[model samples]
Target: MTQLVLHTHRQEHILRLTMNQPENLNSLGFKLVAALRASLQEATRDDAIRVLILTGTGKGFCAGADLKTMNHPYAPGEPDVLDCIVELFDELRNFPKPVIAAVNGITAAGGMELMMCCDLIYAARSARIGDAHCNYGIVPGGGGAAILPRLLPAAIAKYLLFTGELLPADKLQHYGLVNAVLDDDQLLDHATTVASVIAQKSPIGLRRTKQVANEALDKSAADAIIHERLAARDQFRSYDYREGINAFLEKRKPEFKGY
Candidate 1:
């Protein structure tokens, strides 16, 4: 059987996960979701993997959950589709390492929610994105209603949610939804380039920074500052911190071991 997801190591420390199943527009199926979740679990435990890049193959990134299976009645003891998606999004949102979404093509509904879970997003010029849930009369169970508003202006988010119309990648970038929009051929290359730069940073430092950044979203300014201060104080005592300081003083590159 063919793999539903393709895992490729890039620039040594970066792992690129390509959602396969082009025939289905890389829709999330039972096996595909399981494979993705398993990969995330393994990557979290593997210190050598410092960064992750998520994308899809063929003309579409992800069309969202497989509607065929989604509408089917679940067998006894089988997992609920919403529950599985919740678990997947939760794992992705709390991922310690940097995760970049390289949206190469169509991204709709849950696919858009999945992309939002990443730390940063880059898109191909030809990519189109939207809530798309309204079109199918399906309510978004992932981050569409919740996280979308926080990520973009309320009006813009609502527009996407209410209209169910697809917008080009550049338009989303204008609304601050995407970090950058590159040429179709340059999407993966650009994402990998960014991941390579992040991979060279201290792993422990990146982990802590990501943790603090995620926390800041829900925290008051003063509270977030306090949290950041505490984390920084603790980070100052780490081996990687000392190595970084020493390396700077010695005018040499730091070889971080991720502590």
Candidate 2:
């Protein structure tokens, strides 16, 4: 049976996830979505991993779901099509480790939702992006409607969804969808540098901060501040946290075992 291909690599505290379907521009599909969910679960369980960076191999970050595969017979109790997409998005968004999307090429439709799930997004200067569901005569059934507004301004998100038009990488960088844009030749190098910076930080601190940030995204300012203070209070009491604080005071680099 055909399956989604993925590549994994771990270097100390960093976990790199690479979509390995350059042949089809890393299109998402039933099997691919399932595989991604399993992979993220495994990543969360590994104490050694402090950061998770996602990218695609070859020329395409992801081209959204595989249109050709939609013809297959569905299971009797399959998940709601929209729910299935949100599951993947949620997995990435709520990951304990920092999640970064290295958008190296085309990202369209569901692919845009996947990219938006990451906390930080680094796009290749040549990448093209969009939500093209309306062009197919169906509204976007993925989490883009809910996720896009969280990532960008309401007017821009609506414009993109309504028109189903492709936006250039530079344009998205200007629009704030992309955090960093580098020349295609420097894309992987730049993304790796960002991942390394995350990996070098205290694992416990990074995880707590990421969790707090997610929790605060939708909360009132006062509640969010309280949530952050409580999370920090709990996290800073950990053994590794104490060590990190001491290391900072001593003017030395932290050596975190992800405790």
Candidate 3:
């Protein structure tokens, strides 16, 4: 992939999507946003890609929206930068494959929102997170408002959004925003390791599992259970399920055929 803004690399069914524009602290500008959207959509259509990894090059992951673009002339709903972020959130949330966020440094405001969109997030111990939008006379137009409350306690979400204070990765991990925290140098390694395991799973199983989980997040327990039962029964009849069970009985790794 060209390094204009986003770089996508695929190996063994794992796609690592790196945010370019390291010189700009990986800010999401128009070109960068467009590049990312295109690359993600391309990966989405590839049936071989079972796992998606989101990270950034250089010292920082993403600082926020491009300050320069903030002043550019624009028309009504003419594909604003926030639109790009919303698109990304939708992609990650709806992706048939599992999406993991690997954050190495500060990821405030929109960056944090992007991180939150991932199915799982791993961060460097020193990485930071915050809703810096309040400091800029704005609010999170991304999925921040909707997701933070789900990831964290309602009171905790209120304090963070209200104060907009930056918190270290450890704190966020305790708050459930981050799945885990590793050494700065091991951030991507941990992310890739987890993604690799996910990539080895049956694609049909993984996709249905992700969809069911995402859909059940806001559903009642009984409703979620009903959906889960239906999903499990449907997937159990697929060829992959038979392979999985036979492989288990034979004590061999199953060769999943994405069915």
Candidate 4:
């Protein structure tokens, strides 16, 4: 089976991207990284795709980078692991649509970084997530260092980074990072519902809102206001904007064509 599985629910306009290498805990090896990148590119190009739900199969979400791949000597034709990681981080950060993380079991090290980058994270109550880079006598080669501090409190981030310990999903949820802590069986269904609700909205509005929200933290309040105004103005020009207004006035649900 492929390392990555991209299943498109065309009717819902949702794409479920599963990391399929469960035997290796869906490690971020060259194959998995390449497959994920290609899948994201496909999602980007497909207009019908509105929301992306990222999850993994079997026992673990991802066990960070494949030690086997990293330990092996590099060959002339091979892509650098660092390069692949950076590319994946960039793709996740700039993915136009909302990306929801349905985190299952054993999310650690770089896997935790990947989950943190998503717009929303819904975790299974039984899942364990943390930064375990220290355990291997190495630090994060990915964006973990940069992103974790931003997501978590200084003490919490330092504790995880320094100790390399896994924390239960409930603990993370208590920190207000995870959107929901759910039963294993309910994880996917809840994520799908969120995606379906978002998918029904105007695509341009969602994209613009996401763009602004993602960058808001980095911008000044005045700058964010200006940015949001510009985004709202652009949204007004979209066909769906008019459709939404008309539908509201007519007391009917808007059928967004993603224009």
Candidate 5:
């Protein structure tokens, strides 16, 4: 049987995970979700991996949950689809390393939600993105409904949610949802170039920065400041922090140990 997810080490510190069920547009089937979750767990524990890139093979980044299995009867004690989706997304959202979503093609509904979980989103010019749940009379079980509004303006979010219309990546970039839109042929190269830069930074600094930033979203302004201050103080105690400062003074590159 073919692998549900393909794992490639783009560099020593960069991992690219490609959803491989192109025949079904890489839909989030049970096996695919399990594979992705397992990959994420392994990446999280591997200190050498400092960045992750998520994409898909063939014509779709992801078409969302496997529709054919949506209403099927479950086997005894089988995991609920929504439960699995929630777990996978939660892992993505809280992943310590930076994740870049290279949206190469059609990304709809939960596919878009998965992209949103990444730290950065770079889409191909031909990539179509939207909350397509409405097209199938399905309510979004992912962040399409809740977190999307926070990511984009309320009106724009509502339009995607209500219409189920797919928008070009450039259009979403105009709304500040996508970090950049590149030509189809340039998407992966651009994503890897960006990830390579991030990989050179202090790993602990990036992890702490991500932690503080994600937490700040749910915090009040004053509380966010305090949280950031505490996080910074903690980070200052790390070896990478001192190495960074000394490296600058000595005009040499910092050798970060990811401590």
Candidate 6:
């Protein structure tokens, strides 16, 4: 089967993108990253898809980059592994619709970086998460240093990076990194439910909300408001905006065509 599988049958508007490699814990080798990026790009162009859930098959969500594969010298004209990682994260963070991480198992090093890119995360109770780069005398090049601190307290983030110790899902959830910690069997179901709920909302509203909120993370409060105002003004002109208003006044569900 393909290393990456994009499933749209579970719901009309929710796309479930799964890493199909269970061996080596679905490591982010060149092929896997390339495959994932392709799928994300496809989702972006497909208006029918409004939400995404990223997860892995078997026991791991992603165990970072496949160091064995990465150990080889880069061929001439080939992008480095770090470059692929950066590209992947950029796509994840900038994805217009909400993306949820359904972490199933061992999540470490670059694996943690992958999970951090999602808008929300729900992990199995037995999942372990952390930055393990320091343990191997390496530092993270996948935005772990920058992203972890934003998701967790500075002190806690520092400890994880300095020690390379994996923490249980419950611990990270306490730090507000993981949105929910659930039994292994419940992880995907909960993520699906959340994605479905989000998919039911106005696509125009969802896109604008996501774009503005993500931009707010990097801007001053004043700048963020200015951005939001501009985005809202544009959104108010969309067909979905009129549909939403008409649905509200007519007491009916909006049939959003994602315009």
Identify the candidate with maximal lDDT: 5
Native-to-model Cα distance after best TM-score fit, residue 67 in candidate 1, in Å: 0.9
lDDT tens per residue, model 2, 1-259: 8644988887767788889889888888776777788989998888877788899987789988888766666688866445666788878888888888989998989899889889899999889898888888766766778778777789988988999987888887887889988998888778778888988877778777888788886899899999889978888778778888889899998787666
Residue 154 error for model 3, in Å? Answer: 1.9
Estimated TM-score for each candidate: 0.96, 0.92, 0.94, 0.94, 0.97, 0.95
lDDT computed for candidate 4: 0.88
Ordering by lDDT: 5, 1, 6, 4, 3, 2
How far residue 82's Cα lies from its native spot in candidate 3, in Å, is 1.9
Candidates 1 and 2: which is better by lDDT? Answer: 1
> Model 2, residue 130: what's the lDDT?
87
Q: Candidate 4 residues 88-207, lDDT tens each?
A: 978998999999999989999989988987999999988999989999987887767877888889899899999999999999889887999999999999999999999999988999
Which regions of candidate 6 fall more than 4 Å away from where they truly are? 1-10
Error of 1 at 82 (Å): 1.6
Could you tell me which 10 consecutive residues in candidate 2 have the lowest summed lDDT?
Answer: 77-86
Q: Whole-model lDDT for model 5 versus the true structure?
A: 0.92
Candidate 6 vs. true structure, TM-score? 0.95
Residue-pair clashes per prediction, in order, are 0, 0, 0, 0, 0, 0
C-alpha lDDT (0 to 100) for residue 225 of candidate 4:
92
Tens digit of per-residue lDDT, candidate 3, span 60-159: 6887887778787889768777777788668767878899999978788888887887899999887888878787888788866778898899998877
Tens-digit lDDT track for model 5 on 95-202?
A: 999999999899999899889999999999999999999999999888899999999999999999999999999999999999999999999999999999999999
lDDT of 1 by residue, 1-259 (tens): 6564655555699999998888888888787788889999999999889999999999888888888887778898988777788899999999999999999899999899999999999999999999999998899999899999998899999999999988999998998999999999999999999999999999999998999999998999999999999889988989899999999999999989888
Q: Please, what is the whole-model Cα lDDT of each candidate in the order they appear?
A: 0.91, 0.83, 0.84, 0.88, 0.92, 0.88
Candidate 1 segments exceeding 4 Å error: 1-3
TM-score between model 3 and native: 0.94
In model 3, the clashing pairs are none
What is every candidate's alpha-carbon RMSD to the true fold? 1.3, 2.0, 1.8, 1.8, 1.2, 1.7
